[model samples]
Target chain A: MSWELTAADLPDLARGATLLGTGGGGDPYIGSKLVERVLGDGAITVLDPDELPDDAFVIPTAQMGAPTVMIEKIPAGTEPVLALRTLEEHLGRTADATMPIECGGINSMIPFVVAAETGLPVVDADGMGRAFPELSMETFAVYGVHGSPLALAGERGERVIIDTGDDDRQMERLARAVTIRLGGVGHIAEYAMSGADVKRTAVPRTISMALALGRAIRVAREQKRSPFEAIADTLAPTLYSHVRELFVGKVVDVDRRTTEGFARGLARIAPLDGGDELEIAFQNENLTARRGGELLAIVPDLICVVDHETAEPITTEGLRYGQRVRVLGISTPDLMRTPEALAAFGPAAFGLDETFRPVESR
Target chain B: MSWELTAADLPDLARGATLLGTGGGGDPYIGSKLVERVLGDGAITVLDPDELPDDAFVIPTAQMGAPTVMIEKIPAGTEPVLALRTLEEHLGRTADATMPIECGGINSMIPFVVAAETGLPVVDADGMGRAFPELSMETFAVYGVHGSPLALAGERGERVIIDTGDDDRQMERLARAVTIRLGGVGHIAEYAMSGADVKRTAVPRTISMALALGRAIRVAREQKRSPFEAIADTLAPTLYSHVRELFVGKVVDVDRRTTEGFARGLARIAPLDGGDELEIAFQNENLTARRGGELLAIVPDLICVVDHETAEPITTEGLRYGQRVRVLGISTPDLMRTPEALAAFGPAAFGLDETFRPVESR
Candidate 1:
């Protein structure tokens, strides 16, 4: 399905993105505002992956850096288009459409901003179904897409175009360093591919999923029903095989620190009903969710935190002590469950001793 | 004033470059070996800066990152030519000549290796008369050269081409980050300019000076004369206005750390006769030399530490406690004393409370 996104859709989109962010990707408030300002009364056309022609050029883009830094040093609003232009110049072709690299927090809305600025339609898909901290943890990487010829642009008109050949890990490492130097935030356009590749590798319809998710939360709040139930029901019809409410609790402690250009730490959630506590460790996004020594959710799956009452999504940077919250775990898309994908982003990849277990199994 | 640099010149070149390194620029031992292996029996042509044509394209190249890192992860012997190729592709023109970005440590030998591999002549000049830590602290920066369109290449075929647009400080920051990401070391080719611009901005004949300095040290050692006296005599006819023996001491303490892609620390040299101790603080290169708060030499002047008997220049990375050493202060080239030059590399710029006073004055 195709849709036209207008100014009215910004709030819902931001809300949906935050929910899908799963406690990372920074706050979507600034991105939402920037998009709203750039969008004005103009409506942006959102295209389904199937709608794209095989030969159509496509570009995936997102902000690369620490979430904490992105909140403080708000983007100059020119980086996305600048990155797109730089990429276009490098590839010697114009992009037929733009897409979000990840469906998480601020990144989910960045494509819309670019589309609004460049008059390029946004494909309703993303590389990661939900945000993963590192660039190598993307569905595109699993699908063997080259991450190089990546264009990184800073607000100060500084631009770096990287060509890392077949080493995606090195690309991630280099891009992260560039991001830190660019005031800990830089806009990057990577994995330029044909529309055919997009259809093959992308997590399709994520934009629509985010929109529906946002609408569900809004409607649930108005109806005075539990937003957690609404969220689970909202994700039930998606590509995700399972959506379960993991815990209802209050944040008791947050051991967070901004290190090496990342917001890394742990959040301890104490059950309001006085059962076992849930501990979530994160490097930018929530990596693993555990109850005592047992695992509830691990990476390559969605481990999200939301407000206890209104069910507003809380990003990792927004986590604080004494805040009542609800945690949800959604099974990852089947495409992300393969051995290759698991090896790149599984619990063990993050230094956990446990074997791979689906959120559905938990 | 063209000369062929054969295997015979490697020792003197390394020795001379080390002296000019002024207790920074890392060790040249590995670089010398790399160049020697690459050069084999081939002779590289060294062109005088004045001999370059008006339309000839020239680039100043060097290694940018912490010296300590460079010693460990040795170059794959392809970064220089790779960076040159990347730059040439970006500019849509081939390089006519190459030169060291600075006449310090490993950098002074990199161009020779490139010339051996690429069959390109190296200009007998450099952007800095001696090495300074930051990219902005160069004769090219002082003479209004743009540092952008700089190519940075890593060993893993990772390449980043930066277009910084006249902001040298931003260039330095971004390059440093890129270097750290490239395993704390990267080959950088910056300030690509016309031969006219190269002649106008470059510190001419620094290569010949390094050669002379190296040759003098070798001769003194062979003749059983004090190498320090030989060094002073060798520097008498150079652009440097004065050369003075600052201290004869034994290294008592050395404080150093690789931080933010730089070898940063202070080295204390206690007089062998039990006089005041001299402290040299450095960030990659020695920035200041003082005794009990009395400044002896500060950059852009050169403060070099050498073996007390052999006069072998000890790079900042090679400094060690309990070693008998001699410190020498040499006045900077007139081109580096301009107010614009001082502002970029002066004492105050390095967070020192003192103003830049000429080494010749004290």
Candidate 2:
């Protein structure tokens, strides 16, 4: 599959993306703006993971830090290139390159921006095949690929060369330190792998998957199809929802001090579902989802809030009490289902009573 | 050197450590109490770097995050050991010993708590002979040692492992992600290396150095030795000025919106030094110490504010306009100079007009 993403494609991509975001990928609005800035009306060509050569230098790159922070202190957009260039210099090798680190919400277009700047093709695949909170939690980590010796370059000519020598934990530690130093934002080039490594580690053609899901919503809206039906058709999944997002509410409080950018406080969601009530406790991303004392979605899965009609991915910071919202759930796949991953993302991981059971199963 | 710290040792250590903290290492008081909680009447043993066997496993562990955050959310005092134990488990080996990652404020005594709990011999050597902000700006980085496969364990038992396979920058990205996830404060055990690696990379005798310095300040204060003189005797070359602290007045404003728990913000200082007024801008540690008309100590070198006569370290967060304080400058060593180390903490690194001139030469 090939993607020639013109300016016309972005709207549908984002519209469909909110459904795929499952309730936690963060708002695509900021990233969409950046994508538009870079691509303009040009075509964003995306290749299928299988179509690429076996040994292409497949790198997974993105901004890995608090999304809450990124919302406030915008990226210079130049850090991504600086990181890539520095990584190239450090490797003493140049390569057949590809694009974006992940496919969902904002990260989905990073490849296009990077490709436009560095002339590298954006790989249609992504580790985890979705957005995650940590670098180590990606499918690359599931395999033996390490995201180290990462070139964390800020746009302001401040480049941090972090080498954590085969230790998975240290890579995140140092990257985090740089993230804070760089005003809570930094572009990263990581998981520097051969095509062989890419084939084994990455979830192939995840962007196509995203595009397909996106197109589903597109075709749906065009054909008067329900948003949930369109998304489910695109994912080829056996499950999905019919909720429409209507986000317009007042944020009661933003307790950033304790939550530390994790969305913790309740966002009163006076649903267009005509329900009595809905509330969310967020940390970084949305965590628990509830409606009128009914558990809509627990943990270990995504509970995304979108603009009820527009399907705009809503972040915890953006959601407010007394506001209206449409909530939806997206399932976690096998990659984020392992014990380690579960330990990081499960209901128990967030200190909920229930252990991690699959979203579909739960 | 041996230290039998009595219940009475807390105040002097707190004061002296603060003096050594310069202006950026969080409040020494919170850290002082923590050290006191773990160290009560124990005969503390300080060893020279040369004392350890060449092959013994030595690790320097400390908390890595925003110092200001540590106060509101104190550690369970379990983090240092958790980092230690996690590294040991990752290695499938036990640590024969532990050492201070650095000797800045709370970090100075972190090893002591680890020692008392794990019963491991706390080696006297430290990675940074003195304090520098970034985790990688240590003597270990000077010796080409990496700071990863390092584990950060939180009080709530949340842990993430960062291992960047010798790529320094990658580690930072991940660690910070964990830090933000953990409410902006976390404990990290970075730069996992063997005794040989430790021997080559770690600053020799940092423990004895700190103990001597700690003891000297104690003895001098009691024996009528000027505490300043005692400190001068310990560190060799010295430069001191009774520069007033910024934020001497009431903390009229605190910009927490952009603060991800970093020690950041600008404060106006009404100088009590008989010098003109001063203003200071800070990030984590104070980077620039500027007089109203003159650039005193710029970045790359450490600029700390101590109490005018007590030699106590003053954190930037508590700085108001009407306070009385003294500022001191301590230069970084030349041996630990590397592009990354320098880039992370060099004079040019912090946007100063100054070229890199050795303080001794200047």
Candidate 3:
């Protein structure tokens, strides 16, 4: 298949991104619009990782900071390319290509702006098939990739380069804090890699994966079938059974804590279908899902509580009493199924003593 | 040194912590009182890392949230131990030792509480000699240690665990969000390193360094001298320079932004000393300092602005008009000396073009 992103790919890309987000990457609507406004009709050329030359100068780009702030604080929109250019200046070399950090959610579309403005083609792959938090948390870090002399450019008259210890977390910490300081949004060029590292560390064909999922969901919606089932089918992942929700109805309670420049809160849902209640607590993303006295879902996995009708991502802070939602459960990939991952996000980690078995096993 | 914490040491500990914070970590008052209140006159045995047994089970504990919040919602005192006990239960093991993630601020005092309640001796060193912006940004992550089986216990009212792909950022992102959701405070036991990993990965003797610096400051103050000079005398580091106030007067203008859950802001300071005015910016911690368009300090070295008279940590969110402050500069060890560190923290990273020289050189 000839790989090119056109206006037609936007919707599919956004939908696919949400599925890939596994429930925590933030709403794709705003991020999708940013891409759509930048490039339309012209197909984004997708370069296969294998097709890149060994010496290919490739860098992944991303937005770092508060998603809610993204809505209130309009991006300068030029920072993404400026970030790429700053890297080029620091190294005195131009990038041969660009890629996304995650194919799901807003990150899935960031490369489009880079492509449109810089005239660089967006790679069909990404570092993660799904969104993972932090600048250093990528497989690239595991491969010994470093985020130093990072090129950061914000539309609001801010730009800088960060070089840190071989530790990408340092870069992530400083850059993240910087972005928050820069009105909650900043773009950066990171994981500056040789084509070889790009291929070895990044998820291959994540763009196609996103497109496929989006297409699947659209097809299901068009055919009047279950979009949720379609997504589960396409991802080859099953829904966890023990995810019996506490509320099938409206939001009845929300208690918020706003500190550390973040908005955090919990929402209680009362079942329309009949049950005790459900609580979905969130900061910038949904973290824990519980119903009655039973634990439902934990982190490092997508625990989506979507608008029962729209299936759109609703931020935790935006939720209010009497709002309707249906909590959805999604199993995670093996990459996050390692002993390390389970230890970080298993039932035990989230205050639940129940062993987490794959829905398939259950 | 009998390696026993004495009563006189408490004041030094708190004061030194405020200094080491580099103007980012919150006030140490609450944390200090909590520890002092619980462990009155109890000897907190500080074991040099070298003296630690190879089989010793050590867990470093700290509070995760915005420093601004710490001043408002003082911890319930039991939060730290609750987090640790919850972690012990999840690990299905017991901890033989407690350590601070960093020794520069409130975190410096958390281990004391843990030691008093659990009867675990505190380690004498820390991961980062100073405070960092995020949990993943710790010295442990740079050592290829995974921060898993990391349990977070909330004030006994809520407890949750989080696991992420070997990505510390993901862990931070997930954990931070959960912390916010649970009402802005939680205790975390992270980087559960085996005995060997702890030795190689941790920044050794951090506790001693903190105490030494604390003692130095106290002795210097009693003798009537500059506290900044006291720190310089103690660090015996390669560089130390204290800037004469451009303006000792009131704060004039403040710009603020909260993104990615950080209270970021910048303020202008007029000189009461009859010099020119100065502009400073911050996010939880101060990242840059300038006077009359000239850049004075930038990261990975530290730039801290404190009350000119009282060494209180002044967060960016807390910086206001008319607040008198003296800017202090210090150099981090080799971690911030590498080319990578320079690029990540130099003036270029902070949006200035000139290379950052030592403050003492200036």
Candidate 4:
């Protein structure tokens, strides 16, 4: 299936991307504004992996670094184009299309910006169904897709092309170091893949899913219905079928400090009526969620916090004390829960002690 | 004029390079071992910049990161070749010859190692007449030579190519960050230049100067003559004409720490009997030397410490307490003392309060 995504669709897409970002991907409002500024009246053609030829080259682009910094120092709306062009020059081939490397507030929108500028359509899929902090955490990497030759472009037009030769960990390490020096934000084009590779490794139709998710929330709000129920209904037929409202509480503590090009910290939410507190730990994206020391969702599962009334997703950098919110534990797709995927991005990968317990299993 | 650098000549070359290294540029022993392991029976042809055609492509190569870490984690002797090959691939052309980026214990010898392996002649010139801590502090950079596309290769075959356009400072920052992640040391090939650029910016005949200085010391030691006087005599007719014995003292204190991919510290020496102590500050290369409160020598000028009896140069990483030493202040070449060159590697560039004063003027 294919779709045309115009400027009017960005708000809905952003809202849904924020939900899928797992509390860290950069601010959705900023992502929407960047796309709107560049997109104008143009419509981006979004295609499914199956719609492209097997030989079609797909380059995934995203912004890397601390989201906390990104909100203050927004991208110049040109970094993604620079990163894509740099990668193309390094590869000596033009990209057939661009795709999101992961689902997140900014990352999901960055590809569209690149597409608008390059006149290249965007693939409807992504490497990660939901966001993970490091580049190697993607399903593409776990499935043996190379992360280099990776290209990074800063706001100042500085470009760095890294070729680590199958060392994905080194790619993440080197990219993060450069991102810090590039003022804690840099746009990257990496994991250049053929359509076959995308079909094999990418989460299918994630862009459509985000759009549908956002539309569901908006329709629920317009109809004066419960947005949480709308979310459950929207995800019921999707890959993320097991969705649970883990807690309804007010944020009591947020211990976040952006460092090492990442927004790393913890947030605690206590039930307003009095119950065990809910706690979430994150490194860019939420990694683990627990209620009263019992695990509710551990990565590679989605743990998202949203505004209690409007169901607006709250990113990690936006978490604050004394905010009433609803925490959701959404099951990731089976593809992202395989043994290989867990090894790449499970709780242990993020330095958490507990083993991965899926949201539905818990 | 041209010369042949055989394996047997490395010892003298290393000795002279250490003296010119100004307490940094990696350890001479390690550099010698690396070249010896790769050189085998083949001799490296050394050519002056003028010997090559104006359009000849010359790539300067050196080891980056802390010299202390380099001694502990020696290169695999193939890193330089890998670096050079990576750069060649990036440029889409083969290099005509290789040259040292700076004068240092290991840096001056690294180009020889590359030359021996690549069958390319080593240029008898370098960007920095003496070692400086940062990459941009080079005569080539000062006089406007692009430092990219620069290639870095680690022992494990990790390769990174940085293209910062004309922003050399960003190049240094990003490269240093990557070097730190490359286990505190990496091999680098940078400042891809034409023969014309080399002639216009590089300090000419520095390799020949190093060889002569090293041979002078060895001959003086063999003849039971004062090696220090031999040094003075050797440099008298060269670009580094003004030579002064700054101090004769016993080391009393050394405050050194290896951090951020650099060996930074301060050393204090007192006259054997009594008198005002001499304090030398260094970040990889010695930056400033002060006696009591008076500046004896500063950066952009050579400040070397040698063994009291043997007159062998002592590197900053090799500094110890209670060692008898003689400090020498040698003038840098006129090219290095130019206003532009001074602004690049001057005392203030290293965050020193004192201004640069020529050794001859003092």
Query: What 10-residue stretch in candidate 1 chain B is worst by lDDT?
Result: B23-32
What is the fnat score of candidate 1?
Answer: 0.96
- Candidate 4: pairs in clash: A23-A316
| Candidate 4 global CA lDDT score | 0.89
Q: Stretches of candidate 4 above 4 Å error?
A: none
Lowest lDDT 10-residue stretch of candidate 1 chain A: A347-356
Distance (Å) between predicted and true CA of A4, model 2? 30
Looking at model 4 chain B, report the run of 10 residues with the lowest lDDT sum. B347-356
Instruction: Let me know the TM-score candidate 1 reaches against the reference structure.
Output: 0.96
What DockQ do you compute for every candidate structure?
A: 0.83, 0.06, 0.02, 0.82
Across residues A107-192, which tens digit of lDDT does each residue of candidate 4 receive? 89999889888889999999889888898888899898989999999998888888888899899999999898888999999999
Task: Compose the digit string of candidate 2's lDDT tens values, residues A68-165.
Answer: 66667667778677777767766677757665555665677666667776666777777655555555556676677877767776656555555555
CAPRI tier of model 3: incorrect
TM-score for each candidate, following the candidate numbering: 0.96, 0.55, 0.50, 0.99
Write one digit per residue (lDDT tens) for candidate 4, span B129-213: 8777788888899899979788999888888888888888899999999999888888899999999999999998998998889
Model 3, residue B224: distance off in Å is 2.9
Using lDDT as the yardstick, the better of models 1 and 2 is 1
What level of docking quality does candidate 4 show?
Answer: high
**Per-residue lDDT of A72-108 in model 1, one digit per residue for the tens?**
9999899988998998887788999999989888998
Cα deviation of A27 in candidate 2 (Å)?
Answer: 15
Best by lDDT: 4
- For candidate 2, the lDDT comes to 0.62
What is the CA-based DockQ of model 2?
Answer: 0.06
lDDT of each: 0.87, 0.62, 0.68, 0.89
